[model samples]
Target: MATKRVAADVPVVRVDGRELRPGQSFQGIEYRGKDKDGNDVWRILVYAGDKWVETPDGKRKRVVKTDKHTFTGTFRDAKKFKAKLEAERQDGTYTPPSKETVAGYLREWLDTTARRALRPSTHAIYEVNVNKHIIPALGHIRLQKLDSNTIDRFYSSLEDKLSPATIMKIHTILLSALSKAKADGIIKQNPAKNATPPRVEDPEITVLTQEQLDRLLETAKGTRIYALLYTLAYTGLRLGEALQLRWSDVDLDRGVLYVLHKTKTKSSIRAVSLDDDVVAVLRQHKEEQDEIKEIEGERYQDMGLVFATERGTPPSPSNLRNRYLYPLCAKAGVPRINFHALRHTHASLLMAANVHPKIISERLGHASIETTADRYQHLFPTLQAEALEQYKEYRRKHGKGG
Candidate 1:
């Protein structure tokens, strides 16, 4: 009833309206067919370079084409291919707002919004949180597609792995990034707005007893690093802030240290009185630094940093911790607490000494008095006992017996 169909490879491919040369590659094929109504239908078969591709519904599809061509396949096959390609094209059109990840957004937010508006020390802390925690976990996720569920899962996983304080830091970073994204219209919603950070129950702060402090000072004697530990424990300066200090910031005559710049907290900028012992140690340190500068000759940069390397250059935080602090603590036979613990010790000692909470708050440069009170609330019983004793003394003076 019908003539035999041509063999499957009988040179059916055409190029530029002519039969293709033998052995020439069939870059693609094109054809036209008539339906029952005799309407002409056209389609194109694309070569590798002729069309662009995209993924849609987890499948590959052709999104764009360079040239139009006719089709040879059945209508059903043609329609299916066209639909898949269209889906891919449409999906490609729906681009996320930014190409950056969650971590990248945090950096951008800090540079654009925080650095200009917030204090320098505050910016530094945000930078730390972004680098140490947030980027490592969720930096690869696209900003627009980062939904609440994704953030919830990230938090849940962090809860199992990190300390509560560390988890809280991660949450703070995410909240800040999402808030900026919302304000900029990069995201339609703030997924982190309702999220709760991990609860950080206060732990007992360790303070060096007077005897231990004396032993530490004795052990540190005759070493240049001793001045570093003495400064931290006696003055309560943070390690970064201490490292950033310049000789100019010290007021030896007035026995005061001006903390105008800190490498840790934004609120850690205030003047503090120095004890005589601390002043003496600093004076000795300055003399040692000057001698080293003389030895180094022109190599010394004279950066004016109080805690500097032998070359008179500013000391890096890591190098100072490894080379000086850790080794000195080990030699002193004390538990190897990090440099930050020195700050805790200072606060704890002040609390133990019954310093006013408001004064402590101002000295530490905390954002609010409430934060200071919350941190040292455990010392209130001591304050309360002192108050009761004062009341008894008043009663005794006024002839009101117990």
Candidate 2:
């Protein structure tokens, strides 16, 4: 009779002079020869205690489950790692490796951890990135098998299809997810820490000149979008932030508006002062809206939004951009610009008047003064030249310089 081959009965793999066998125990550490990269490889097998399993005859047998690691480093490093593993074993802190896939872990994480921690809008973005981009590429890889090189390759693959700034956003999401996995003891470390993402250059900011802005407002005057456009230009608020504004949040008497919802950060929730012209425009806008509400009666869907459609519902951002803003820019004979450029226009106007950067940072609701400074640093050279000219004029007047 021929004997059936068992897993342990198979041939042993010889690396250099060392013998490697399946399920074999090591004293502490063993040299496993060099890897493909010519780095010395070592193996460590630590006993992880045992459990009971049913035998063929309905009897019970003790099955010892060992935690093993193949280290790609020197034997000395392997010994140190072995010692660490032994220490963890002594304290019952070591986690056995898992065979879960990246997709499985990410799905679980998004449903439980990320959903609880992230805001609704932010969480929606994360979900789209994960389901649409990440899972399709890296989902098949085992969670334990994922490494920095794999992540780097994945990022490289996206270079042709996505912009550097967009790729950076994806990297941020992956890094956050992997960081949580490490904290939960699901992975030994975050692979994203070593992965290299594409570099994003600081883009040249676009802003409308004061004359161009005047023409734009003139073209948009008496139109429904005028108030929204004026608000964005003067307040420097993001399109989403302005759209989320409520009637209650605006105080026409106090000459200020509170940014309560759709704010990017805690710093973004601030009181933005309104100019007299802006206050007057808003008061007129309110009266017109009240008349429309009375005309619509109960048919209007009033959600207290300051900017809404004729039915009192929030207007679509795409419609505002394509249907209104672009056409208005053409009619006004001004260079076409996105709504965000209006915010830049406001900041540029303030900077031209020599407004303090600290006040600018506060008004823009930047997380730090450094952020504001870094963004507008391109405009500083002209300001510096002007300052030097002013100093020279002062010296000439006082007869201090020839």
Candidate 3:
């Protein structure tokens, strides 16, 4: 009979290395060899203060933290490792990091601090990065054992498969989490502090020409999603902010909306003005929704979303584009772009019409006018052309040049 090959298991960080209780003093170092670096490496040791820690091979040993010549993070070959510890003891210069694993600390941080500090959507993203990416790769390494070189190598491996933006996000999670560990005295210093993360390019913008926008609206006018399409083009609400909306958020009489949620920063929350056209569409949509509610009666879920499935629940944002917007865009003789193109299109249209950037920022719920300007920087060349023409006209009128 042939034996089947089994995949090797990954190493796990051990939490019981230094079991010394406070007020109990530890003396002497045990010389253990380089760890087996294999399955039997999972030797969990527990000893009374005076007893010896035995290696799996029957010799006595204890894995201690070291700053140099490390075999497994801080763990080194026990003979030289013991000499270093003894010297540190004589000099009184040794400080030990906690025996916590990277995975363990990250779980705690997410459950306690990150869950409270970040928005739900943002927390979800962080959770995915930590649990899915960081944990699987570095979880076995002790938090104190984690070093810049290890982190850099991990990032280098991800570069081909993941975008620099994604790698940067992973770096941000590590830097922030490790900084917290340092603050709590879990580690002496964050190894990630000096690590280099990948550089990210500015987000690409996609805006439609006025002719395409007109054709799209003309085709969309009487469709079920027209109100949504029009709202996106006019108000620039992100797909999430738009989908998360309730009837209460819309003020038809005031021609405004209060955007309470979106991805990224908290600064994305702001009030947006509705054009008269958008207000009219919203009003009609509301009346129609109200009539549907009356008919559906007890069966209506009443989620209060402005855009919803026929059953009144918020549909997945991804599905909304493929099912409605993309097909409609194709039929309308316009090149298809992602749903966010409407936001870019809205901002571009405002800039082309020479509207103030502050108003554009407010309408788009951007954190600042600087953000608006940066996003629309591509449009500024046309602005310069228009300005040059105005300057020539002024010169002709004043007779300074002919």
Give the alpha-carbon lDDT of every model: 0.70, 0.86, 0.77
lDDT ranking from best candidate downward: 2, 3, 1
Q: Candidate 2 lDDT, tens digit per residue, 1-402?
A: 011224755534443345554444345666555567856566788897899999999999999978767777655567788888889778867756677899999999899988998888789988998998899999999887899999999999999999999889889988988998888888878999999999999887998989999999999999989999999999999999998999999999999999998689999999999999999888998899999999999999999999999899989988999999999999999999989999899988898888998888888899998998899888899888988898988888886554
Predict model 1's lDDT versus the native: 0.70
Judging by TM-score, tell me the better candidate of 2 and 3. 2
| Residue-level lDDT for 239 in candidate 2 | 91
Best of the candidates, TM-score: 2
Task: Please give the lDDT score for candidate 3.
Answer: 0.77
Task: Identify the runs in model 2 with alpha carbons over 4 angstroms from their true place.
Answer: 1-84, 91-93, 396-402
Give candidate 3 regions above 4 Å deviation.
1-30, 33-96, 262-266, 399-402
How well is each residue in 1-402 modelled by candidate 3, as lDDT tens digits?
Answer: 011223353222222354322122223322122255531111112221254588789999765534322223232333345565456556645444357899999999999988988878789999999988999999999888899999998899888988999999999999889999888767767889778888898887889988999899999987778888889988888888888899888889999898885545667777888879899999998988888889998888999999887779888877878888899889998989878999999989888888888999878867888988888899999987987898889889887566
- Candidate 1, clashing residue pairs? 31-70, 31-71, 43-70, 43-71
